[model samples]
Target: AWCCGAGGGVKSAFPDLALWTAGQRVDEALSTGATVLSSACPFCKRNLSDGAGNRNVRVTDIVELVAQAMSGRRMGLT
Candidate 1:
């Protein structure tokens, strides 16, 4: 897992910057040939999800994915 750009006390004052940071991280993920990205923090998940909108990738909290798995729902963790 990696940063989602929602930390470092900047998200509250500079949401745009946080999104920009998340975009960078998401770009890195795209290069890895992965389609799914997961993080444990809610803030990270939110920022990452926002930055990754409609980018052929899925961002989610790992705990949610585990719950989905236990419920037999179709999901991924790439």
Candidate 2:
């Protein structure tokens, strides 16, 4: 697992850097052939989703996945 780069006010103080960091992490995830990246933090989700822009990967929260599962809905990016 990697830091989503939105922690410690990085997203607010250094948005570009945070995005770059998240992109790097996303690249690592893609290297693993992952189609989805899940996080428990809303900040992480937001940053990861932004970093995954135009990429064939989905960034979502664990709660969302759980909700989808409970609701019998197909899991997907909203």
Candidate 3:
């Protein structure tokens, strides 16, 4: 989640709220013309990806992108 409003014990304690919060972030990301959502935190990635659902968005970790970049592979929605 780019804006950082999801994850931590919130998702563990209140899952519905976590996904709902993640949805808000995904909406903002969509507005910015972002095709891929990236986060280093597993919780954020999981929650945000769940929020993305059928939308044309992909959730990834920054490390993955860096690795792709190092390998000279373009990283983005395919």
Judging by lDDT against the true structure, name the best candidate.
2
What's the CA error at residue 27 for candidate 3, in Å? 0.8
Model 2 spans with C-alpha error above 4 angstroms: 71-78
lDDT of 2 by residue, 1-78 (tens): 779899999999999999999999999999998888889999999999999989989988899788988999987545
Lowest-scoring 10 consecutive residues by lDDT in candidate 2? 69-78
lDDT scores in order: 0.85, 0.91, 0.81
lDDT by residue (tens digit), candidate 3, 1-78 = 154446458887887888888888888999999898888887788888888878888899979878888999987788
Superior candidate under lDDT, 1 versus 3: 1
* Backbone clash count, each prediction separately: 0, 0, 0
User: How much does candidate 2 score in TM-score?
Assistant: 0.86
Give the TM-scores of the predictions, in the order they appear: 0.81, 0.86, 0.86
User: What's the true lDDT of residue 76 in model 3?
Assistant: 78
lDDT by residue (tens digit), candidate 1, 1-53: 56677897778989999999999889999999978888888888889988897
